[model samples]
Target: MKIVPSSVQLLLERLRATYTAEEARLRLSRQAERAPERTLRSAREASSANISSLWRQLGAAGVEIAGVEQELADQRTLEQAERYSGNIEAMVGTVKLPVGVVGPLLVNGLNAKGLYYAPMATTEAALVASYARGAMVATRSGGVTTALLNEGVLRTPGFKFSGLIDAGLFVEWVARNADELKAAAEATTRHGKLIALEPIIDNDIVFLLCRYTTGDASGQNMVTIATDALCAKIEQDCPVKPLHWFIEANFSGDKKASYIGLITGRGRKVSASTVIPEALVEKHLHVSIDRMLAYGEMANLGALLSGQMGAQGHYANGLAAFYIATGQDAACVSESAVGFTRMERREDGLFVSVTLPNILVGSVGGGTGMPSQSAALSLLGLKGAGHGAALAEVTAALCLCGEISIMAAIAAGHFSSAHEKLARKR
Candidate 1:
């Protein structure tokens, strides 16, 4: 479907025009003339009347923000945000993303089993509805099965040597002292466990990607700190150190797309699958299961031809909403959404699955503790260390639901119509 690009200029102009009422401008001018020496900040500090007068001055100054003013009309206070975030400035109210619940999406996972009302935060009009539709069909078909297949957070520390022999010798030394390196890494964190050290050997350079299993947390920060300690230990202990050594040669796949993440997986490696009964497919999705399979074939061909990272439909649509609602590091969406999804004709119905190798999500750290984010997680029955594994599985399940919905839309040729009806404001 074609997406209409938003114009920041146009939005700003509307805000300006909407709030710049002639009466408001005139009232502000009279007030300003009455007390030309009055300052807005002092007025705002004085009383409610002065605050109203201050807003008038801004409006009279040609700033149109009546809508924004109305939106922040009852802003409680900004002081509390400092607990969850750093570098606090004045509280800038809120950007109220409409949150919608999809499901009773039944999920069977190692940690999470049962029905959930998945909270999705998004601006797209039909996104929540689409996911909810997929969830309904999946629920009727007996739910998605999710597995936490693997877990790791990586930090690749690089070493430079004079020659191949020197680099090879360093690699040998590191391997010989693997236990000590592991100890050094583990010493830094109570929850992080040093699981493996994977090496990439160039002629005269070596990159040791340290992998860790961080319990119940995404553990990017935990893994990075542990890797730093390990590197320091190597510098101090390895007598035949490289001519130079540095932490993070960029092979760890932090906050960016890389083959390393796609292959090795930097966070939770999760896979979710489901079988939709034939009757349910046509009844709920309004398309034949075989036609969905054909669309999948076309999409896979296109992904292969275009060298796309993920061979799936609309993984980002669900993942972005999920992450934003849950207060996950939304940037992780870049890596998390690169999913491998498949659909095939089955004897009874259609078999579908989504494999998300690097689903970097957490229920404890980062934005999960913030009020809105916490509420979203709580809505899903996920909000702490114990729920991390379940969160990963749920993420995979949600991705599968989205893949089914989007592919069905494309296959049925209703993608554009759906968007035209739902995306545009009436």
Candidate 2:
């Protein structure tokens, strides 16, 4: 979506509280006069000496410097337009499964740059309204748009390296006895491929990690089956003695118990810790940094990691809705949800930002090609691979906006004003 020019004007209104037409026009003129290129230069030039000055400019102009960085990154994403042609994209794949509770419907503005959400599925219907109110709250607090902003993606490859086998013997076996091995593996109705990977040890077993793009599905199971078939072939072929016969899959390392030896147990509760800047608390722009730090100390940031809350919260309600509307493995949200939200004093106000590293989101292939998902993709004006990352960047921005809005309300003691009319009547 196009960035609105009125966004800056709205922020000025919040800061000035009230403004004449002339004042509004002047603010707009100042922002307009600052070229996008200059904004980039200022961000790049942010130094200890002039950092305060640069921050004041951003605060007064209602420009988020970090958001600009995300935008620049998005504009440079690898797409067909970038002319990166490789079979790797075609080789990697994904799979989806059903698991866990589907909690809460969230909402955010269409033009929003980040994520916003409410807890409890019962509260889902009100999510959109809450964010809209939140948007207004932010606008009044020198904020401009109510939308979330995200602009990038992260992809985790589906394969890992394994130990080596006797390359000379393995090659000889493949060449001399290909027909026999193929016939035996076919007995079990297994489809497989033979590829010689780089060696590991001094020849214990021919270790091959099967890697392939499973074509619009989570390929974990398919890879496992194929690997098992190849293992059986190795056992039969040119074997001096197959010692150290072990299988590792699911991309987890040898540290985890083997699937055969694994004993399932009840899941454990999660706990985590994080640091928050103290200056934001002093500005009444946030809860006591101590409180957030305490929460982290007590529990892992799982709930906060999802939906629109906490630092690094992005993925506008639209993105989640889009994920659901499409056939994506929404539970993948678990890994994709990990990120950081940071607040620091900049000039007289606060500068807020978020960073998400393991946002294992995908765009093309898999459910993205489904009919419903295709329609949702159309709605966001997205096509091909990098849309998921773009959605994520927008989601993170919205999440930061929500936290900032709530923090401002609590600090100003106006957090409960939304229900004031009913409270007064009672």
Candidate 3:
């Protein structure tokens, strides 16, 4: 299916003239300035003095030293420091962020079917307030409906061959010996099961896209380990030995946005939708349905023009905050943020929906074991096993709330003013 509908494409083409040349000029003019050349001193020696010296160097470089060392040290106990062994390299200290709660956000989904107070960790002001407003509107309008559509984690390992014929034979061998490969992959992990192995040939390279269902975990590392074992077995048994092979072929769209991920999905595929009454829209957002829909159309046009993989307003904002708060892999947000947002006019009100194909989140692994993150997950009652689906659903709903709120703000011409009033600290 085409990501952007034909009707919307035609509409954008027709309205292309409305986009002023000055606006294009301003956008083209905006560029990043070059940074000053300076190297911060660091030592391999782990000592208080070395750390202090680094901080002093930063201070000398005109950086604000906001007692970050003291605050991080205050939170870090010896036990907590021990816990950071595998999670960090050359452990310095932990930075604390202000976590805000937005809730009583009612969600009606297959897994998430209750009122959840989602904790968002961020420094951006008014973010929590904006989501809270949308949540309130959704709750008042009969709650957001969500669904866990599909779930799988992928890791593609590539094998290099001398020519197309060798690669073709290898692909045939992989297709015929699926059972053996599955057994090899499954042997590495108890919870993760090898669901499918698709072989794609590119001239002399053959990429085996291995998909897995990781129980209650995001499964980046899990899939890598499993795929590694599978590759080892392939190397040992396959008659047509490859010239070389690598664990990751960069075809799985790990930690990066890709059209394949948008289509096939890399992680938990989820969708959330809610209807806001026209009266509620005006009451809360101070915008009419007509204006909101118009703005949404313009936003969609902008997304298409910018070559965005999926059309949506700020999925990263909610995903990033939620991931950090709930101990998810924050880097996964790159792919996780790819989604489609639809806002259509309804008889009673406006129907807003968000479909996120890549929501890489888990309630059991990674940072979920951390004390602060665990507490945050517990706050939403989404800690430990059997709650991964619910966590994904809640994440989709949270993103839906953000989409509604931001679209309304932009339509009502309150986007900049709200940021100025709330974000700027005089």
Candidate 4:
């Protein structure tokens, strides 16, 4: 006897068919063309004298420049400062941050393995030391296990139509011509690949959620340029013209925290877990396994009551410091900090794990080329290509260390005292 498929099963089959069809078309039309060259006018050398010249130019333009020149330009240095042209505009002196090391953190991950000394650049006192203590405990307990679950960067572009019929027709056309759009997007960058194009329709509006896998780089600007090219192609070819459209509809959750980022993820989705022996927890954290677990439950409740996106403690402390030290987009911490922390009881010990859905980090590109940031990445042995996943894994593990330490401190009733001793003066 033959059995009929259920509604859910049929829906799954249809979705699989749609994906396979798009993949087949992409494979067939994989030839990518080079993007058009765009250049900006070169700024003068990034030297103090050149800065003074610019200040003179600004002064001539009747802009008040004496204070800025005295404070920022006077403090500027010439050590490879010329390279700052691409990274900054209207050059001012760099603000120096004290960099601290938290490791020999042992990470057993798919990409990241062995011991690493993670560099954290921040002004916050006791942050690095707390992470260091947690790292020590984790290493003694056989290290943290990390996994890079998924990776995708999204860029959503919206379109306006006269009515629902036009919007539906546009969505159908986009779905049918996904391959061409993918090709156009891929043409803009050698490293970025257009992995998926999802159409979300609302009445007379259609939003195309363009997702890409950016190789080795965070791919923010990469996706934007590629999507621009794809939009241009759509405008030229699609028979149904949009009444209005935009390159980015602000639906991607770029630097802001949102429910969509928590659900679907924006960058690298990574998780780290470890089991700290009960004895180790008692010795190092001065807290019993049961106490830690109980505190975690209370913390989870407080997070929910406060409307937190994901229940966790101080994921931002490690993420922000790591991002700044390793040359990632620091603002991304707003979204990257959204994650879940789980603490459960095991026969052998207390099991602690952290799952971060949005970890926008890269081993190369952007600020990674800067002198201090590059050095920090080198310190962790995570510099250059083929290390983005490893870097992300390390980041997740680092966050786990922070979570463990904070939970232990709060549970043991030492959180305030430790901070007072480390951060305040008598």
Report the C-alpha lDDT of model 2 over 1-426, residue by residue, as the tens digit.
Answer: 647678897886786787787887886675654566444223332133233444456656677666553332232231221122221122111222221122121223343333222211112343334444434433334442222222111111121223344444554554576556445433443332322222223343344333323322333344445445655666666454444455542332221212211111001101111122345344434455444444433333554455432233333342243345444545554443444555454444444444433332344554556444555555544446534434443344334444444444444456577345324443
Candidate 4 colliding pairs: none
Our tally of clashes for model 4 stands at 0
- Model 1, global lDDT: 0.83
Q: Over the full model, what C-alpha lDDT does candidate 2 score relative to the true structure?
A: 0.38
Candidate 3 C-alpha lDDT tens digits along 1-426? 799999999987876676676876776684656455777766654345545676678778888777875765554433365554445544455778999999999999999999999999999998998999999999999999999999889999999999999999999999999999999999999899999899999999999989999988998889999999999999999999999999998999999999879999999999999989899999999999999999999999999999999999999999999999999999999999999999999888999999999999989888898778989999999999999889999999999999999999999999999999988852
lDDT of 1 at 282: 91
Q: For every candidate structure, what is the RMSD over all alpha carbons to the true structure, in angstroms? A: 9.1, 24.2, 9.2, 16.7
**Model 1 weakest 10-residue run by lDDT:** 42-51
Q: Please tell me which predicted candidate would have the highest TM-score against the true structure.
A: 4
Candidate 4 accuracy as TM-score: 0.86
What Cα-based lDDT does every candidate model obtain? Answer: 0.83, 0.38, 0.90, 0.90
Number of backbone-clashing residue pairs for each candidate, in the order shown: 1, 34, 0, 0
Over the stretch 1-426, how does candidate 1's per-residue lDDT look in tens digits?
635446876785786776767755765574544554643442213233443555677677667977866565334323343443331223334467789999899999887799998999999898998898889888899999999999998889899999999888888898999999999999999999999997789999999989999888888788889999999998999877688888889888787777878887889999998999988989889899878988999999999999988788888889899999998888888888786999988887899999988888888887787778888998999888788899999999998888888889999888888888888743
Off by over 4 Å in 4: 1-49, 55-76
Query: What CA RMSD would candidate 4 show?
Result: 16.7
What is the lDDT, from 0 to 100, of the residue 111 in candidate 2?
35
